[model samples]
Target: MASALIEEAHDLSGGAGDPLVHLPDTATALVFRTRADGRGDLVVVGPRTRAAYFAGKDLAVCVRVRLRPGTARPLLGVPISALVDRTTPLAELWGGAAVRLERRLTRLDGDRRLILEQLETALDARMRGPAVRDGLVGAAAMALSARGRERLSDLAPRMGVSERHLRDLLTEDAGLTPKSFARIARLRDALAHGGRSSGLAQLAAATGYYDQSHMTAEFRSLMGVPPGAFFAGRLPALQRC
Candidate 1:
């Protein structure tokens, strides 16, 4: 099923003057940048180990589709493990083919629907990756992405595979160890509850921390900010590049 490999496509654009703050994320995404001059770039935003801050964009619009785990390898034409915590331009990997695709996109003049369709067609043409979909990795990733305290040791047995084998598969296809994926999933849950919760302590407990303190430490560790400031939109000083 498409849902197993593709998360949701999203429009990440904001006010032209507002800086962008991207929180830590567990998935890989195809970021399509459309600048004001009717030409731009298409880049792969690999998984993030921590939050990232970007200066305001002069681009007219930006859209992204977050690909589910276990689905990007064929499209990338490289081992997923190589992309961890890195951003790469498609041209570096796809070469002239990538350049030709950009020319096609530039000719579209930034029409959102057309741009998305073009990208989708290109992905659909990939015979193995997203099209056929990797069953074992997909199932394992979904289980871990549920944000529960599911141990790989327990999951491995249920799936009829050794824990080491499962770990290796995910590390290669998902570009993250089982433990790291789980941590990001929990952070995602916390973010979903950020604005709706009555208080930070309650939110932390609800999202699976031992207590507020445990949650605070993780927030700092992965996102470089305490939950309070993160939820309040008051990020600490970060060197924006």
Candidate 2:
């Protein structure tokens, strides 16, 4: 599981520009945002295939908990596929539980650590529930994120599953096909070294892309901008949930 984050944007008042964020392929985020007027909202951000624009209001505080791949479906009580490329209010999914959580958060004082602890506890409880674990999905995600590029066809036989079965498992658990997940894994690996890459060609080679053009096309399709624009600081820095 990704670590929880509590971000306070006290400086952002009166609608400051929010940065564009590229959500990762393997996780979903549960975000709780509170504005100056004491209005709080809860949202579940599903796996995003593209970059998203977000900004905070003045004196706003945001708390986020990121759920690991294949875990959100059980916690959210719905298939991850239902949430792909969308953000839905927590109330719509969790109903009264969402309301109770918001109320508890609103009543708390400005203790970021405490807030994070509470959120983590909530997630822990959900994870400990009767959710069936899919080891194959987790293994597939690990393989995709590993140092070397792995072909799904080859990986499937090694995992003792057929290629079609592997695809179905990934779709049900990760909300993505094997090919798409691998693409995202490669993209993330490249972006992690964005600050130090000598050039596009070098980045492409290091990230296992066919070439610079292949990397650029994937970057543009997923990030809404080319590598040049993204690395130039035109887009907002990615905030991991």
Candidate 3:
């Protein structure tokens, strides 16, 4: 396998640790990063390939527009469900409007600088279109909020929506239900912290799993590997100071 492409990101504005509002560089997934204080949002366009994390499916295709970083929240303006989560092409999502950006990456025709500038301008504007379902979109963003991720049952009640209803909303906006999203988010957090050396028991407890086996099962389903085998060689590089 090739090494994962890591970009030496240039800070557009604001200082470091502001907040990261980045799109997946591997797919059209929008990610809101509140991992560190003062880190601004880092909007990224994912590479065209299947996500190593999600087996047997194509990653979503879209641009992540980072506005600010600080705990996940309802983005207020962006649509949640308009984009598909499974292997959809970005060109199909934007209907050729993003030709410049795509061409630079695929055809290598235009100046990447200009393409980036155009994308930035569009991101700065508040999104508006017939395809956007703002009410549910806002709710979805709120669902992923820092506090919301911790309390699933409480979230639906607070929103005056049923648990099933909340799941539907999440599926529409995020292409996954609340439970699934929470699971992935928790797992990602655990991996980020534990790396390879962390055992199944530890990762399970941190993510609220009932036992190590449960976490192991989920790991296989989502990541296509058992917990132990997944981190065999990569753990050392992922450790934190």
Number of the top-ranking candidate, with lDDT as the measure = 1
Order by TM-score, highest first:
1, 2, 3
Candidate 2 lDDT by residue in tens digits, 4-103: 2211211122344556354455667787778657877778878777776455334456666666555677778777778888889988888998888777
Please state every model's RMSD to the true fold in angstroms.
2.4, 4.5, 11.6
lDDT of 3 by residue, 1-241 (tens): 1111111223232233232222222113322222233222223232221114311211122223332221011322223344333333434444444444444433322333443454444433424323344355345544553332746577778777777877775565444455555666656655665674356687777766678888777766665566687666321122110
Q: Judge candidate 1 against the unseen true structure and give its global Cα lDDT, from 0 to 1.
A: 0.78
Higher-ranked by TM-score: 2 or 3: 2
Candidate 1 vs candidate 3: the TM-score winner is 1
Lowest lDDT sum, 10 consecutive residues, model 2, at 4-13
Identify the runs in model 2 with alpha carbons over 4 angstroms from their true place.
1-18, 235-241
For candidate 3, the 10 contiguous residues with the lowest summed lDDT are 1-10
- Pick by TM-score: 1 or 2, better one: 1
Model 3 regions lying over 4 Å from their true place: 1-85, 100-115, 124-126, 130-148, 196-198, 234-241
Number of clashing pairs per prediction, in order: 0, 3, 20
